[model samples]
Target: GGTIHIGYFDQHSENLLDAMNESQRVIDYIKDVAEYVETADGTQISASQMLEKFLFPGNQQYAPVYKLSGGEKRRLFLLKVLMSAPNVLILDEPTNDLDVQTLAVLEEYLEEFNGCVIVVSHDRYFLDRTVDRIFAFEGVGNLRQYPGNYSLYIDYKEVEAATKKAVAVAEKSKETSVKPKKSERVSWDKNKQRKLSSKEKREYENLEKKITQLEAEKAKTENELYNAPPGEVSEVQKLHEKVESLEKEIDTATERWLELAEINS
Candidate 1:
């Protein structure tokens, strides 16, 4: 097997703190990992410069580790891990206690990281921003792999559920059609009389596909909004409006689908 170096960041910082000297300044703690680390673009950066990049300014870098806030400690731990320059990074609930600015910086860092990242997080926006594939746990000992981001995975599951429900409805209809009572037969005749027209039937068949497409588009737009650079206020607003519009479209199509399904049944 090939050799792999793993850098891990846990949500609970106590374990990491116990291994560190509390009196050490943040810069010293980071320098202990490395005096300088190379960036993705081949330039080497000093510990202080790297700390600044991670949102620790010059003043904050001189403070003792014990004086840092909970969120700051977590951010420091994350920076330490990154400074180690491991090939594989494992983050367990890395978002806990982290401020939004830190989270955004981490997201940007991950975008340029030249390594594999395995994250266990419940933050949907984080997952959407950082990951391209998902491993979803369905039940005990049942983990399934999906070949897309979190949003796309959710879309697939929803479509699968709808298809299953349609199949169940068709089976029930078949079972009821066999040897129905007189009143039941009359009800069946009424249902048949209200069957969907050719165009309606086509629309019904395509609604699921259409909804899936719309959902995917909405997911993409939301991701764009998340990654949009600062000061692009107008662009952000437009993306938000697009997401709401797609939501409305999905709702309208779903209602129409339900109507056609009822008529056909």
Candidate 2:
């Protein structure tokens, strides 16, 4: 059976080593904290190598986990989780205290991970980046499954609410049999969005493809950065810059596409 790993760090952990600086080095923490056998890939890896590759270079290699900043400790915990090589990862509020850079890197790692990931986070951006499915808790101990990322799910919900309002208005008009004036039909008026022009339609379609390409490129560049060797610092830096530029472009394109979609509605 596959293992389920919960990547939760107890802030108030009472273990003796957790209190002391026994795991004096981040490398030592990684080696001792998680249980694992050597990977079949036969790739020789050292703690120093992982530190450099994950952008935690120089002094960070030997820094004690207890002495590290909150962000650093979070990153270290994440590294330990990865080293454990579990088939399923369940992260509870994984974004707390993590810097933007670390978050981005972790998102990239999740994207390329071979196993399933179940993430619980209040960060909309993080949810949009890491998950395609969500289990939302409704009242009365019920859980609802929503398809797509957080942004897409939100859009779906808004459209659904508008549709329901329109239906309710129609049903009420049927029961009353009083033909309300145009201005009185508030729900209809509210949802009567503008239609798109031919040019706008074409632009929206093109943007969809372009945005997909950009996203794929961004993910690829992120993986490149994650897998970059210690000596390929320049290559990694260039890839990072490309990812940032691509993200901005994608965001602009996505926003324009959304605007066009609203008009098309």
Candidate 3:
């Protein structure tokens, strides 16, 4: 029932091209929306000034829309939508076809925007930088709300998975109720006293090297995740998974190394 203005940006910019004349100059296209618009800081700027903020220079502003590059056209369309001054912005896959420079500027603009931004994107880095809350869609028409960003949501899921695994192991142990006999326990202790086998010695040396390599790889992957730029959704996700895999490998190798060390001692 409340009055709210909505601005929608479609990933497929071709559909919106009908509203924009290819023969029209970029500055005229924006001026058609508004000659002057107020920024979030309560400062009024003209159409050309606003264009410059969006990375359009004086010469480029006078060029026809048809002469602009594909990325530039996409940026112009986005600026047009924002210049209309809507209270709510709905961007669908906005990162598609946008260059890194434009994406960085857009992130900054969203940070200062007073309106509500509803972004539907697969870009993990974008979501982590922009939104504080997440609405995850599970299968079978179930939608869940998380109170944090994309990274936080991933942490929650990992914790949930570990908890479930632990509970299942506990339940299985209770059901089995198995214990070794006294002779079996003595045999195990004797086995621990024996020196490492030839094959195990080789494996033990390899495990130490493997663990060290895995640790280095994990550190590099973590640094990549920390410094990754925007619009790298698939790369970021892959780096996260690689880090997890390396951690598991390090743990397993360390356990084997300790086993061999105790036997050699």
C-alpha displacement of 156 in model 1, angstroms? 1.1
Off by over 4 Å in 3: 179-265
The best-first sequence of candidates by TM-score reads: 1, 3, 2
Q: Give the winner by TM-score: 2 or 3.
A: 3
Predicted candidate 3 versus true structure: per-residue lDDT over 1-265, tens digit per residue = 3679899989897578656799999999999999997778888889999899899999999999999877888899999989998889998998885789998999998988877889899999999899866778989899876545688668757844654574475446435634558877776567566888899989988887887787688778767765565446566667667766766666566666755775675
Q: lDDT tens string, model 2, 1-265?
A: 4356544433322332344464578777776754343333545456556556567777777776767765666667667766776667777676665678877877876766666777778999899888766678879999866555676557545544654564475446435645448776775445344466788778989998998898788778756655555334346446656766776687678667655654455
> Per-residue lDDT for 68-95 in model 1, tens only?
8777788898899999998899989878
Q: Rate the local accuracy (lDDT) of all candidates.
A: 0.79, 0.65, 0.79
Stretches > 4 Å off in candidate 2: 1-23, 33-46, 179-265
For model 1, what is the C-alpha lDDT against the true structure?
0.79
| Winner of 1 and 2 under lDDT | 1
TM-score, candidate number 2: 0.58
